[model samples]
Target: MMEPAVCGEPTEPAAPPPLLAQLRAWLAAWLTDERTARELVDYGRVGHYTLALTRWVAIIGQLFTVLFVHFSIGIALPLVPLLAAIAASALVNLVLLWVLGWRARLSERAAAGMFVFDLAQLALLLGLTGGIQNPFVVLLLVPVGIAAGLLGRTFTATVTALGLLVASLLAADPLPLPWFTGGLVFPELYRFAAWAALSTAILLIAVYTYQFAEEARHRAEALAATRLALAREQELAALGGQAAAAAHMLGSPLGTIAVVAKELVNALPADHPLREEANEILDQVHRCREILKTLGPRRAGSEVDRLVRAPLSATLRDIADEFGRAGISTEVRVDSPDGTPEPCLALPPDIRHAIANLVDNAIQFATSRVDILVSSSHERLLVAIRDDGPGFSPDILDWIGEPYLSTRHDRGGLGLGIFIANTLLARTGGKLHFGNTGRGAEVRIEWPAGALERAVEEREHDGGHD
Candidate 1:
């Protein structure tokens, strides 16, 4: 498999470079690549709106040229004035496109300010010619859509007010589209009123639609976070139960080695190299005994995974949101057996604790971003947390969630989080898995529900007999 790029290991040292080397390096990296193109998909709306605005500008320019000639034949103002105005309109449109480009690439705050510039330019254009009568005044939709899509509720409302104020001021000031089509196209009292009513309706709908879409997006995100939390709990439980069993299964074999080593020690000659090696073997047995002693008092061979249960959406969302508020860009998406959020029953806090630990683990290493995805089959709820950070070492990946295996030497090898995480999950009846995910490592919590239910049932059966 390809090595992960962002493993959480301490960064490798970079070679020194000459001055202006930084600038050149920056420029070279900025040269667009596949990733650049992929990122640009987010700017598709800006590209689309640019084209729409460009088309309007062209159409309005042609209309202006024709109107200017007709006005020159009879009006008091010089043909120069109208032509100059037309030139100015075209120049402003060019600037609008430029600003639009900037808005697409910039942050939300910057985009809001740029949108103000776009609005003012269009409002100015409406004032120069005819406000409501300027057929192209309907071009207001572009900026309105921009506001609705990019601006927050307050900023959007502000933009709407400015647009309406500008439109009303221009509408009352009758500027005509220079009619070169031989007949003057002018709106009467009722006609202009109707146009304003219809356009206003359209603009309001766009704003409302934007708000609806944003709300839906937030709800979906919340749902997803909930699912991931649930999965993390389930997966952790499963991991723990399996590890405990594996630890238990080793006991018999380890005991046999201890017994055989005792026999060999008795058979070896005194002070011999062979006897010294047998003594070493006996020490190894003692170490093995020490290791297994950590398993505490287990009912030997009983199901440890029996207590784990899959978590619900509400549980997962809280985990993601809690991390997100701490400046980690956390996102959660939840998929149940039906691939939707249905009412889930209450689950234990152990599952919640196991998942929060996973999120906290990622928050520690993530540069700025974290994602949690939750899905479950009939058997297990799979919770995966992926981060934009350095990932695990190969050895760590192989044994992560296993008791005593750790990657944290930086903080003095405090790895009990994984041990506890694994133990908690196993106790609850799930599994905790850790590995590198491309630029970061992913931790998966898998809960096998049937095994847990079976274990619970077996306990109940034994209780009844007792």
Candidate 2:
């Protein structure tokens, strides 16, 4: 016998749910979660005009079919009910157009509701005509398929389930098929087979359509992100160029100040107060010159020449230095196969930024060391960045450079770094390869000899003409 519960005492906690029940609950929660839906399904916008136009077409088709069957074929359809259903659909479409202007975009819920209405209307028509026995019963898959492409999984599943329910009900008991003689009757097994076929088709079509649409949407979003990242890298490079220009312009003034300060210090007595002030001025001028030196290439030449060209070794070394972290050691090595001098190529900002991004990614993943190797020959140039850490996951290795494909969720990145790097490199006629080299992951980028250089030169020439 159970004892009476006390006011403050807690009752025994309910027994844990059975495994099947728990699984069902989990699935329901996952399907209903709004955040998951938004992330998985990016149904951008459904315009009112588009929905209205499609509805108008469907209405016209339905009208034509009903009129032709009833009058031309002399088959007796429940004309009043059939016409009423079509008119109801038209009226609903009209109301939608009136409330939401033609150009207005629909919210996900509203779009889903419109699809539900379409499914209901189609179901009603099928039930009246002959349910699954009618050839037109196949139309039941249409709304569900469309919804799967444009709506979230929850809404799509709901529509599909609704369609299945309607089909089942109609198959069990529906109006006889119209005929010139009496109403045509179908076998129970035939009706059941038709229902099964339609249900299977709806599920299959919905799944396939959703998968294709989702993949296309993901690709589009990833491309947009890649473009944005490239634009940002270009901006930063432009800012660096501006800094070089500033450094160039200020060099003469700073030198003049240093010279004036030195003269003042030499003219005055060693212990004079003005001499100390002059010495301070000289020190500041020296400091300013040092700061400017770090801002741009140290080579003595026109600003454009200094900023536009760099040896492959120097570029790799600069990137390694920039990405060096306290725990990681970055090394850059350049090899010339024929014992020739290092190639001094036109260094476009896009290329520099792409190299830098790859180096940074390597550093982020490396346990202790990142190595950048650049090898050039008469035929091709190759750059490989390798990291001594856990290599690429086997599952995603084949998809390494694709956008938003990353195994580094621990690093809190959207996985666009590699994609952006790959895209920028490709734009400059480079091909990238990904692999693991026993110790860690390696990304190899290759370009035909002189390809990048010629590309850059042509771009500069075009810019000059522009």
Q: Please provide TM-scores, in order, for all candidate models, with all chains considered together.
A: 0.44, 0.66
The model with the greatest TM-score is 2
Model 2: which ten-residue window has the lowest total lDDT?
Answer: 31-40
lDDT agreement with native, every candidate: 0.61, 0.80
Task: Give a tens-digit lDDT track for model 1, residues 235-304.
Answer: 8656646655776789889889989989989988797688888889989989877665444233323333
Off by over 4 Å in 1: 1-104, 180-188, 195-199, 223-260, 265-350, 353-466
- Give RMSD to native, each candidate: 17.8, 11.1
Please state the error at residue 313 of candidate 2 in Å. 4.4
On a 0 to 1 TM-score scale, where does candidate 1 land against the true structure? 0.44
Over the stretch 17-122, how does candidate 2's per-residue lDDT look in tens digits?
A: 9987676556434433454435223575556677789899999999999999889988888989999999999998876655555775565666777888998898
